[model samples]
Target: MTPKEYLEIVHIINELKDTPRHCVTKNNRIESVAEHSWRIAMMALLLEDTFSDVDIDKVMRMCVIHDLGECFTGDIPVFLKTDDDRRQEAKLLDEFLDTLPEQLSHNMRALYQEMEACQSREAKIFKALDKLEAVIQHNEAPISSWEEHEYDLQRHYAFDVVAFSSWLSELREEILQETEYKIQQEQ
Candidate 1:
């Protein structure tokens, strides 16, 4: 890779590392997007029972590289991302993937495309796990830490829960219930 490209990659990784996530954990730690992706991939593996028809490997791959485009676009909180912004973000993702080796780019692009469609069982399940994890993290955090994610959930993500499997959807609903309980407990 050229020095410029190498620097671009490095810069991207560093920015992701520094990006703060909306939810906090039981340990009072904020999760980064990178960590969130890793965790969700594991969630897919462990919860494969919920996604019978989908390829687990592909689902995992999709989850793993799903947010890589965010390395360039920065972390757009789920709530603040407008429909136009999401379309632009998708374009940005494609452009960045094109920078990779052909095979790698092709695979990542396919994975991202699958994620976007969310038509497959795996895609739906993956989306559910992704949001569920965030809600879980937010629930575990102190009450004061719930603004960006909660706002996003109410504004943009309110109807997204039904897009996933029943299991995943239930998990998401449970997360919200848990978060509310936690907030009440904290108060």
Candidate 2:
């Protein structure tokens, strides 16, 4: 790749560090999109044993690039994204991918597409972990960090995660119970 092209990729990737996760929390300290991606990648690696059939490398790649579009679109919380928002983000992502070297861009696009498809085993597992990680982060945050509406939103996400992966059912239940306890405690 030309030096200018390489620099462009670096510049865009760096933007992820500045993109904050949109989830509400009482802690008032939000995680960057880069941090969230890193955690999701680590979760894929650390949970490899639980999903013996998955390709860990592919899962890791999906985890990292799944939110790369947010660097351009900003982190639009899933609950608030409209069809137009998704189309815009997809367009931005396509443009961003064009800036990379051919093979890398192709591979990244494929991984991102697989994650979006959510049909393959790896995609399903990654999706489940993605939602699970968000709830885990929310649970770890200080009590009352979330607004009243966020509780129901989080529960919806947690239940969806359970539906995606039966292996995560126990963890999903624990997160819901803990979240409920925290809500009650705050009252």
Number of the top candidate by lDDT? 2
**Whole-model Cα lDDT of every candidate shown, in order:** 0.70, 0.81
User: Where in model 2 is the C-alpha error above 4 Å?
Assistant: 24-27
lDDT for residue 58 in candidate 1, whole number 0-100: 75
Q: Scored by Cα lDDT, where does model 1 land?
A: 0.70
- Candidate 2, residue 25: how far the Cα is off, in Å: 6.7
Cα distance off (Å), candidate 1, residue 74: 1.3
TM-score, each model?
0.79, 0.91
Candidate 2, 17-40: lDDT as tens digits:
999986534456888888888988
Worst 10 residues of 2 by lDDT: 22-31
Off by over 4 Å in 1: 1-14, 148-164
Given candidate 1, what's the lDDT at residue 109? 73
**Worst lDDT 10-window in candidate 1:** 150-159
